[model samples]
Target chain A: MSSTLQSRWWSWGFRSAVMLYFILLIVFPILGIYGYSLSAGLAAFTENITEPLAWKAVLLTVKLAFVSTMINVLIGTMAGWVLIRYRFPGRGLLNSLVDLPFALPTAVAGLMILLLLGPQSVVGQWAEQLGFSILFHQPAIVIAMVFVTFPFVIRAVQPLLEEMDGSEEEAAYTMGATKAKTFVRVILPAMLPGIASGAMLAFSRALAEFGAVVLVAGNIPGKTLIASVYIFGEIESDNITGATAVSVVLLTFSLLILWLVNYLQSRRKGV
Target chain B: MHVEVRGLTKKFGEFPAVNDVHFSIAKGQLIGLLGPSGGGKTSILRMLAGLETPDSGDIVFHGTRVNDLPPQEREIGFVFQNYALFKHMTVQGNIAFGLEVKKWPKNRIKERVAELIELTGLSGFEKRYPHQLSGGQRQRVAFARALAPEPQLLLLDEPFAAIDAKIRQELRAWLREMIDRLGITSIFVTHDQDEAIEVADEIMIINKGNLEQKGSPWDIYKNPETPFVAGFIGESTIVEDVSTLRGFEQAADWPGTKALIRPEYVEIGQANEFRLLSATETGRVRHLHFRGSEWLVEVDVGASRLVTYRSLEKEVLHPGEEIQVLVHRAYLFNDNDSWIMENRLKEDPMPVHI
Candidate 1:
């Protein structure tokens, strides 16, 4: 009986320690930000959010993140399909290279994009000849976002494709469905949940991207400046309330998107 | 439709999954491709369905070569071993998929889907997805979906393999009856000999990428053409020397000394019960096993251990008891050939009541 009581006390101690660590590390900071943002009163928070420059920054961030998510969905879906379905030389090397973005620092990725698309580079010269610059603009911001979030959709989709039964495709073919129809009807639906969840994650990550976007976005207040950069600018100018308010907005949006991803995944499993 | 395969072969890398095999199926006949696992039964069925390409062969459907035809144009319906029901689609939607692909009218597709739902006894499961159904119900849905477009031939690769044993037996009968009613040329792959015997109108035994024999169940069981067939079809024990046993000494002149003796060919009785005591040999009972409906008695007859079934109505025999044993017939075989040999005592003047 004494041994059982001792084990019970030990279990309680471990549980409380984990709970205290989580609250201190994660929950406390987020709540502090939310409380600090509202400490200046709801009117001040609203005024700061509705400021024309701040509103434009948030809008631009959402728009660019959506664009980057779309691009990732297309390229990542194709890459995942090819990697899973085909056999070729250097395939193992290529598969391992997909996770390079996640391993590399975001600042380094930004520098690489800047170098590759800078005015001095061949691609930049070609683009200039076609009448526009790619670096220090919306295109550069998008490129940086794409590079940083390149692995999300592909990593999400590869397992779904791998777990798919080959005989399902063969069954479709034998039932008079053409190859294109089978792919559209059978394969696409199987890949959709993965693509959707991955896209949401990429979008949320792109919205919060500061290291890569700051280097290439030019920080123009009403133009290419995203919400994260605007928050950083507010912090630099000692407007703590403004920075916290903007951070709250992004945090809330990301939380909603994450909840949506969880809901979609659970629904898929339930089905 | 009549189906004929000539010199069909399929290779995976350097391994031949199906090597130079040929067979023909009559219209409306249900053929079972019976074999051990990894014996190329499924490969043959897949080639017939146009799911796999034969390295060098002709797959003639109604006298027309269809080697170049894609699966979509081959007019064959295939049921995978796992049923492969579309998990995302409802039962009605799954059944309507092939019809929609064939460009059937929307109203006609709906009508056909409803008809199949009723036929497969899935009357109220039309809106239920594959995951919501039981294994037997999932199999019925797969069958309904494959038959929706009414193809000329049906190919099933281990159709009942995924179900429970009791349901497997029931589905076997159901599938055989369904194929007979549809009158479509059907071939199913299986490793179960009893299932093949009970359900298939004709059974083709495949082994190691070769078609060993093809015949009706009774003919295949009684007259196995190859040694593999003889050993595979029944519970036969292979003995190295048949001349050492009583009445089978005439096998000494046979080409091969190896012989297969089934439990039914060996008779065990008491001393007074034997009519041909002169031809009988005394052996000690080694063991007895309860086989649900009968007792399986194992006897030690000289150098050979023979197993025979005893009726439940007979008196129980104990182990270590000496009993009179009689050999009626055995299948003598070698690597290249096999033949049936009856006991010489059956031709003797002594009357045997066995």
Candidate 2:
């Protein structure tokens, strides 16, 4: 009876410690950002965010995040499907390479993209000849965002694809469904939850991306400047309130999306 | 449809999974491929369904060679061992999937799904998803889904393998009845001899990627064409060195031959009452087990032990008791492991009637 009581106390102590750690690390910081954002009142907060440059930065970040996440979901899912299903030489090597973005420093990824497409590489030169610039442009920003966010969808979907039995698709084929139809009906439906969650992570990651997008986007105010880079500019100009306001907005949006994903998954479980 | 597999073979990497397997099934005949695991039964079934391409030989359906045909073109219905029902779809939706894929009219698809749901006894589970259904219900949905497409041949890979023990038996009878009612040629692969014998009209024995024998369950049980079949199908004592067998030395020389003696065929009697049996030899009872309806008594026949059954008579047979075991009948296999003869009454002059 004493030993059981001791274990119960230990469990409670561990739970409280974890809750306290999360409260101090995450919840307190978020509350601090909100408090600073509203220090000068809601009118000052609105005026700070209503600046044309900052508002355009927000719009540009949203567009980049959306487009990049859409591309990531399509390409990453296909890559994951091939990696899990097909047997080819170097498949293990290719599967391992999908995590390169996660392992590499985001700034280094940005530099690598710069080296490959920044008016010097062969493809970059060919694009220059075609009268289209890829470096320090919208495409480069999107590309950098995609590079950093590539692994999220693939990592999420790969495990799911591996866990699913191939017999279901085989059954579909024997039942007279074409290969394309089988993929669309049987395989895709099973992969949706993974795809949706992965896309959300990629969107959030792209939304908050700083190092890679700043290097490639050139941070042209009201043009290629994104929300994070705009906040960085605000911090550089000694405007902590402006930066904190934008930070609270991004934080709240990220929290909302995460909560929405969790809600959707729980709703599916309820069904 | 009448299905024929001619010299079909499949190899995985360097190992052959199904080697030169050949068989033909008449139209509307329900056949069972009975074998142990890794015995090529599933490979053969997949080959027939065009799910797995054979390395060599041809698969013909109703006189048309379908060796190069893809699974979708072959129009085969396959029920996976795990059911493989679409988890996201309702039972009705799962059944209608195949019809919808084939571009059947919406109303026709619904009508066909309803018919199949009723046929598979899943009328109340039409709206339930695969996860909501029980194992047996999932199996029925798989069957209904496979059948909804109206394929030429239906193949089931261990249809009753995943259900509970009691439900396994019930589903076996239900599946057999459903197949018979549909009048569609179907073949199911199973590792259980009892399941195959009880459910299939004809049983095909496969071992180590080789087709050992194919016949009715009764014929395979009684007159097994191979020593493997004899040992596999039913309970029997196999004596490889037949020369060591008591009262069989004077028989004709069958080099490398083995003899199979079924338990029920060996009649046991008391040592003093040898006259009650024909062609009798003396042996002591090594062990005795009361099997409720009968006694499974093991007799030490000199070099080896022979297991034989005895009725639960008034005199219960006990261990270490002297008894006379009559070899009423036995099967003999040749050197190449093929059935040579069925040694019946008055067969050899080796042992005399006591």
Best by lDDT: 1
Worst lDDT run of 10 residues, candidate 2 chain B, spans B340-349
On TM-score, the candidate that comes out on top is 1
Model 1 Cα shift for residue B102 (angstroms): 1.0
Across residues B1-354, which tens digit of lDDT does each residue of candidate 1 receive?
Answer: 999999999998998999899889999999999999999999888888888899998999999999999999998888888998887899998999999999999999999999989888899999999999999999999999999999999888899999999999999989888899889999999999999999999999999999999999999999999989988997999888999898889889875669999999998988887777877899999999999999999999999999999998877899999999998999998766678998887666655698
Per-residue accuracy of model 1 over A90-109 as CA lDDT, tens digit each: 99999999999989988898
Pairs with steric clashes in candidate 1: none
lDDT of 2 by residue, B259-354 (tens): 778897677887665553445778899998889898988998877788988888647877888877776666777656555343343355566779
Off by over 4 Å in 1: A1-11, B350-354
Tell me how far the alpha carbon of residue A93 in candidate 2 is from the true structure, in angstroms, after superposition.
2.6
- The candidate that achieves the highest DockQ relative to the unseen native structure: 1
lDDT on C-alpha atoms for all candidate structures: 0.92, 0.87
lDDT of 2 by residue, A75-112 (tens): 99999988988999999999889899989989999999
